[model samples]
Target chain A: MARKRGLFETFQERIGAVLPSALQEAQTRVDDRLAKIPTRLNEYGYDAFGLHPESSRRSLATSTLFYRHYFRTETFGIEKVPSGRVLLIANHAGQLPFDGMMLGVSMLLEAEPPRLVRGMGEYFIPQLPFLSWAAERGGNLVGTPENCVALLEADECVMVFPEGARGMNKTWDHRYELQRFGLGFMRLALQTETPIVPIGIVGSEEQQPGLMNLEGLAKRLGLPSLPVTATFPLLGPLGLLPLPVRYRIHFGEPLHFEGSGSEEDDVVQRKVNEVRAAIDGLLQEGREQRAGVFR
Target chain B: MEKVLITGIGSGPGRLLTERLRTRFEVLGVDRTPWEDHPAEVAVHVLDLRKKGFEDLLRTERPSHVVHMGFIRHFKGDPNRRHEINVRGTKQLLDHCHRYEVTNLVVMSSSYVYGAFPENPFYLDEDQPLSASRSYPEIRDLVEVDTMATGFLWRHPEIRTTVLRPVSVLGPNSRSMMAEYLRQERAPTVLGFDPMMQFLHEQDLTDAIAMTLEQDLAGVYNVVGAGQVPLHTAIEETGGVAWPIPEPLFRPGVRMLFGAGMAPWPPGAIDYLKYPVTLAGDALAQAIGFKALFGLEETFRSLRGRG
Candidate 1:
């Protein structure tokens, strides 16, 4: 009974089935390796969460619990993505970051077990010496033009948040709508010829909305903004706190763009428009399905 | 031709619908065969219904109008099995419906959801909450949610669905008050007091199913008998001895019997027996447009006669 399994258990079962034992051995080996390089790693990424958890297998357990507790959402078009190398692009909805984490969890929960699906993240963080070293081990990579090209070519289910820094800023309307997607994804799909999957993350904006902005405070703190939320959660004594609101990540169809051009720019741009149209369809669908995924 | 596939044909309403629907469409019946008995015209297909991949059957049948009827009874063993068949099966069915682009679905559920015993003088209906907290009710309640949600949440809204929950059926071949009367007859002796009872004839259930399927309707409904009776009367009508067993004597023994694993009432069934009470179904009567053909007396008479 599919409904009996529901979305939570079904994702757990399918995704759990996919993690290879070799990855387990590799992860174990990596854990052992990371123990030796722990001190050097913190130089790149801030927030030492006791050094990131070794296993990427936290998709099912963590994803299910996170959604159940935080984001009360409904799902649709989840069965649309056929198993294979796919890319999920969405809007990043927070000044600080949790949008990527939430969507990462959704992808894990949505995909079958041993989901080797990887996320294509910004390169800046990973290139930060040791942090970049940890990012590579922890499945974080830069979304640079060349990096994305390689990631998509490698068949990684890379997730690109086009709005990036711009979309995360506070707005009055609470629109988590995507900013103009750069030509990078369109170019990547043309280059790798892999299907581009667009995901729309709603509810993430409200989970912790930045109703007010402080630019000077941001300059002093070296942060994005002094985005005031309903609650300023204390991270550590001096660290910034975030408002805890629920979140929902919605994924859409894979806009197939494989081999649309025989290395011709005209053909590639036409294919790019088709892919854009597909992404737009998904974005519109995410908006229409607002009743379900959003509050 | 309306492609009609009904699941759980061997159980209650599924079987009732199978008999009632055989005349109208290409009826493909799904049920776990206790033993093979093909009622010509209604092609019966055996399935665990819970296990994955059974959607292949739903696909092959290519039913335009699906009547999802399969579900293990509350008395059935393994609650996981219950959730597996009812909840998962509906999900599978909904998925199949989506894949096939089938337009209509009709599912059968229980009026027992009304949270009451048959003896309760008050009427039981669709509005009453299933009081879903209890174990058995939880299974049935969740099943109802999936059933209802399948209709509500599908991506393709073209498929209209109908969910019917029939009260204790008493029509032809249905073992209504007879089972209770027989139970009260303490082997050779009979119990002194019997509870009040309400029942719906299986034939009336058949008619209601036919009517609902013919018209496209999406909602939950209650099916109950026309009249009610005390179990004492039901016992007499069924030719069983009506011996009054005092509560003081009956209560302790029954409790002890149940406490020991030897007793038959599974924990859920124990709560079932204690049905708090419920109201009559007004919504179902208006929606289906009919009256229950068999009362307690007729139900007993029909049971007295056949298989």
Candidate 2:
């Protein structure tokens, strides 16, 4: 039988034959250098970690690292960010919660972007030395009102998903549905009257297909439901892993609540609804754009 | 059982009510300004919530009840100014409230919110919806709701948030038309027979606050004091005569003089010339455990620099 060889394999074989030190070359090009920033910046909740491009050289050296990777990670309507200490709210998508991570990375890339995001929960920071080093320098942490206000007062941008755990755990059955958002964000916004910048993350769900509901297994595990994708359950290990799908992030304009004082119940409820609606609209827009990408 | 911190405690109803409850409570008094010789004042801290680092102060002195009394009458300036403290700073305080589990809260609102006029009878009760009126008072209404929305905390009750609107606090330092006339030497002037006004003495105002704190109430209330009379009569009772000032001279001065930060707004001023805004709240007063401690006789008598 003739040996079956494809164009991708043939290209790899040719590279291996030409440069016998191929493994070494690949290792040198993808070295992960995560350095810690000054503690003062950390105190203010700033992290430089992997954010700084390898400053020693340009495209050839490691300096343009974050830029090369993230420059391609596109975002739209960032001008919609509300000025001042605002609650940066967005929809939660994907089982791994990469949506939140990329959003934080985008803010760091912002021009004079207020001290990265030094306010979020500690759980999101992966324990890996390289990732943690990057996160520490980047100033990403937990999502609490106290932390949010501290970050805002420090002039650092703070991001929070009002739906908390439930929102991020959204499955295929309810991809864009919002769980009951904790009213804490609303209260803080009203009390601080911080402008709210609604962000929407699409394509994350497609990256990790959530196809089915395994009722018996999920109940024993105590999760909302298993984080499965459309064809994943049949794929086993690959099913649990995320597909490298294209992603899109969109931001809606800032909303300022004119009345910051005691509101009648109806008025308060209405304002909260408006903010939620804006986020929903942005999410739909992002999904639509990502849909066209697939077509 | 819960630690309550009331700021701007040296003046107005804030200090009086705080002092009364201080003996039995762990109350922290904060004010940026001086005490101005208030008779009943507990230990007070000089600090401005409006200034930055408000969150730092809150983290250090975490109290359950944050009765915000520091904000003044006027809400004009940079449109973004009120958000500095009224909204953002208050959020900083609420963040501490949640951190320390200091759930109970009672913030003072203005009866001028009867201005929202949400297509209903303008009785200024809990029933009226406080929509945005693009005015300072209306903004305060929003501030109240936003603070209350922070969380449906469970501590003293199912939820802990209350807003009190005192219809024209009648007292010594008040800038009511009666107050302004007291500062002047000549007779008071009426544009078109200033509308009847309600009065609530400092003590009565203080007492209402004390009652609200003691009861640990949630939601909104209109604390309208009894015994009201026309603005001119109210001024006359304060030992000033009414001289009808012509629209020509009066209009410019009202526009120029009172229009500054030292004065209140239109309905706050000119609205008095109309029929008068009677703030009647039977259910609210009953719910909060308050009795009209000062009547027209007492409120009028007290305005002459007397008890």
Candidate 3:
């Protein structure tokens, strides 16, 4: 320029010229999208089922960065999830449960009429300290039959992973393999007369690849499992960071069954097998369509 | 005119109940100390319920209705004194009420008697066991007083006893532990738990007591406000910050503060903050035809230096 500005000053001037408009444009887009959501439908109220509006809004904003920018998550067949009182049954894997967060994001951002999907967490979630409170505030509940029935009765969309912890702790050699499903969710679907939507989440299995598990150490530390990954423990806390893998979420058509929610093992198992087959079918289809693991 | 004897007049709800009932009935108040700002229409008597002189006052007043609002809550005094006043004093009062042939007796119990446990159902009805004493010895007196009152109710059908187990009472003038905790600049919370809580306004509870006295309801009822909120959310709405600490460290921290006389609550009180003990008020509504004028939000708002 006229005064022969320094290199730092030149860079500062360039950033100052564009940063405000860029930030304002991003803010406006988020506000417009949020304004479209029916925020008043806190049918359970602000903290109902432990879903705090402030906490949830903040958590979702942070997760959105990972969902859109880091993972570049793409959702397909989102319209298949019916409105009101439906159960979302999905495959669970990855040492970390980012899959649940991704599915929640897809429902909020991509669904026709954005719905808050309440996820049922594992049994050990409530035992943890800060994680338990944060999880609840983010609209996750302890997995229990009573909680599921109450949520459905309140006309909420609930997401569940019937595979439980077994699926989430799979080794690197067994990636993408679906675990045996628990039958409780089937009984819940029948009891509430709610339709079920089978979801197949690809890429989450490869997010945090587990090589081995240290059971004794994990038990002593009060953890479900101590996973030894390529980057974990070896790299300390930094190793816990998930590798950026493109996520593809497939939501299948809703399936409805008519029966009394019974505790009989055989009766419930038959229904569980049907839902399991649907998810496995979707998982296979998603794999065939993928260009590559990281694509 | 019918006469009513209201005990624990020094407490907020007791005084409020006296003010509301004085216009309709001749009211007499009995407490360990005198109420400095009570209405002139009500006659106040200074005496201890655990001591020997209350029986004579009962004989002299011969009140048609007796309101037992004098139970010593844990935060106000020493544990031993609270136990003696709550358990033994209640027993003595019941014996005197039976002997005097009082037509109606209303006792104030707390929802805390149900105890805050992990496995509790969403809404605790009147039939739920008094489990608070199991974990916290501080609330043992409350369970005993409740047991004695219910047992006395069956023994003397003519008394027509109604035990009102209300949830946390909060207002501009409330002195309950919950109200005091909410009024703090920063409310301490358990690191891992955010239990749903219900609050009833002081006026609503007084109104319920008035109804119980005016009517002939004769069973235990759970009195609660319209709705509930998570403990942290309530604190946030009231413009207070939540100071969360780990569960293991919380007890020892409270103990240190208590030792220095800086903490307002006992260490045993941490259990309530960790789990929920919310009560369903449907039974109270059905029994007394009661509906809360202030919802849960309004109740919390009232605690922020406004009525």
Candidate 2 residue-wise lDDT, A1-295, digit = tens = 0011143246544655665464334325433221221223221122221122231112112112222232235678876675557678887766665676667655544323322344364343332222332332334433445445555654445687777656665666777776666566666677675788887776665556565556668879754456556656677776665555555678788888877636676777788778788888987877766645332
Rank ordering of all candidates by lDDT, starting from the highest: 3, 2, 1
DockQ of each: 0.01, 0.00, 0.20
* Fraction of native A-B contacts kept, per candidate: 0.00, 0.00, 0.33
Q: Supply the DockQ value of model 2.
A: 0.00
**Tens-digit lDDT string for candidate 2 (B250-275):** 65666676557554443334333332
Give the Å error, residue A21, model 1: 94
After aligning candidate 1 to the native by TM-score, how far in Å is the CA of B3 from where it should be?
1.5
Give me the runs in candidate 1 sitting further than 4 Å from their true place.
A1-295, B74-76, B117-121, B135-157, B175-195, B242-262, B267-279
Model 1, B1-307: lDDT tens digits are: 6778777777655666676777678787777774256577667767766555467776666788887666665432566666666776777777777788777877766655554332222344455556544544535645464445545534556777766766656544553323542434432211322223455677887887778778776676766666554433455555555444434555556557756645444434433332323335567678767677665566767655533
TM-score of each: 0.44, 0.43, 0.82
TM-score of chain B taken alone, every candidate: 0.78, 0.77, 0.96
Q: What lDDT score goes with residue A89 in model 2?
A: 84
**Higher TM-score: candidate 2 or 3?**
3
Top DockQ prediction, candidate number: 3
lDDT leader:
3
Per-candidate count of clashing residue pairs (backbone under 3 Å): 34, 35, 0
